[model samples]
Target: MSADDSVLLHTEGRAGYLTLNRPRALNALDHTMVRRIDEALTAWEHDPAVATVVLRGAGARGLCAGGDIRAIHRDASAGGGASSRAFWRDEYRLNDRIARYPKPYVALMDGIVMGGGVGLSAHAGVRIVTERSRIAMPETGIGFVPDVGGTFLLARAPGELGTHLALTGAAVGAADALLLGLADHFVPAARLSDLADGLAGAGVPETVARHAATAPGGELAAHREWIDSCYAADTVEEITERLADSGEQAAKEAAETLYTRSPTSLKVTLAALRRARALGSLEHALDQEYRIACAMLTSPDLVEGIRAQIIDKDRDPRWTPDRLAAVTAAEVARHFAPPAGPDLGLGAGGAAARDA
Candidate 1:
């Protein structure tokens, strides 16, 4: 149970483990940390001594909040700098590796898991959630579309829940996460230690499965009606209009949330979610996201959104479009255009035309 400073890389009996160690910022995935994780996983993949690989974050409050947005903001401010675009490429590659890793990957999703955290955990074979777990894809709130293969999982979610979450950045509790298929197992926080011990022992998978409790009833299932109806509309503007028309207190609150956000973000996000739904795999989704993300640094709304939210703490972002309805179809379409390059440096079958 002992931990180290940046990362705690150790072997607990037969299991190889890597724990994200920056608790204060909710273990946000920084560039260096992503490289370290990749290195550790690569080593573990071939290590005969390792029976299973478990990825977890330190502290009780969060597994990982997201990528270090402040860093990206700083890099973007430097004006198309060397490191800014490279970071996105490397991070996206890391996400792809995790999704295609060749082992039984277990993600201990104990607490708040957002953006980058979701990328790390969601694709794993076993995503274990506790009662305290609070998970979501909150990228749109920060003026970024959900990357980290978010499109793969969110697109696959039942009905319009994925689209709703991609747009609104809603947080779901453990029960809801289970019902939504975002998590595979639900275990109590108190039993996590015993479960980890079992995972490191002879009876690994069975032990973990035994400790898992079923998803609780209500909440997510009940709210599915409202979420589906509200998010089914064609555009963010249409969705907002529907929410406004509903007159329900929850719908009213949702409408307000949409109004307060950057219009460009909502537009880009909705388009990304729709495109991701049609994609075939995590690799495909990340590839599509890379094209959009490269263009994001040049967008006016991105810098302004980050400045207001993080740099200035103003909470007032003056998006370029000013209104969701004003974002033109051609503008949204620009994000998906292929980057000018000799090659995208992707793996097998990656160069083929994407479904969307």
Candidate 2:
């Protein structure tokens, strides 16, 4: 429990507690954090003393915001994409391990869970969210296609709700997360500590039952039909056209939001989602996303988007192929093709059988 530990590891009863320690940074995952987590989880996986694992962020504001996007920005700008690739390779493996964990894995998703944060928790055996929980996959806004098995989760969402969320990068609360099957239980923020205490004794399922209650409610389900309809198109161009023409205000708003994101990301993500739907396992989706991630590292839109929205704080990104019509099928295909480097290492089983 050292204050300086980026990830604090401790054992209480049968529960292994992992605390993400960079509260000031919103517990953003870095390569060190990812490696530390991998080490801890690998060690704990076979320890008979630990029956389940509970993960949370140290700060009250949230679990984790995402991977340190600033780091990605820096690495992408440096060229070669060597650093970015290494990060994703290990991070994606952690995501897969969590999903197929041998023991119960509980994720307390409190607030601001997005991007890589979603990667760490979405596949947990039991995902518990509080009223303060805000979850999303916002890669499109930064000119990056969603990775860390995002395609698998989003592709599995009811209807095409995943498409809307992916394209818009909209943050949804606990109720919506539960509705979308992204989370398992809804606990109030105030009761989270009690919930954790119980987990140290009775384990996640029983502990969650003790504190779980009806979620306040959310609007995502109401818009499912709207989302599934507009996003049903095979391409980003068609989806936007349909959304723009729809009479519903939600559709119009969605259209506006999509317009603000990277056209390259929107198109590539759409293709990824479609491919994910046809895949047999989560590993397959990660392999597909690895290709996309490598492509994004060199894409003009990714650099410009990160500069405008993050580094420069300008909010406005002059995206190359700014319009859907300008994005060619060949260009999108190149994103899905394997980059000239070591593969993502998912192997025949993809990420599912990745070594610890």
Please report the candidate that would top TM-score against the real structure. Answer: 2
Task: Report the number of the highest-lDDT candidate.
Answer: 2
Q: How many residue pairs clash in each candidate?
A: 0, 1
Give, for candidate 2, the lowest lDDT window spanning 10 residues: 347-356
Global lDDT of each candidate: 0.80, 0.88
Model 2 vs. true fold: TM: 0.96
Output the lDDT of residue 286, model 1.
84
lDDT per residue as tens, model 2, 129-159:
9889999989899899878898899888899
Worst 10-residue lDDT window for candidate 1 reads: 347-356
Candidate 1 has which clashing residue pairs, if any?
none
RMSD of each: 3.3, 1.7
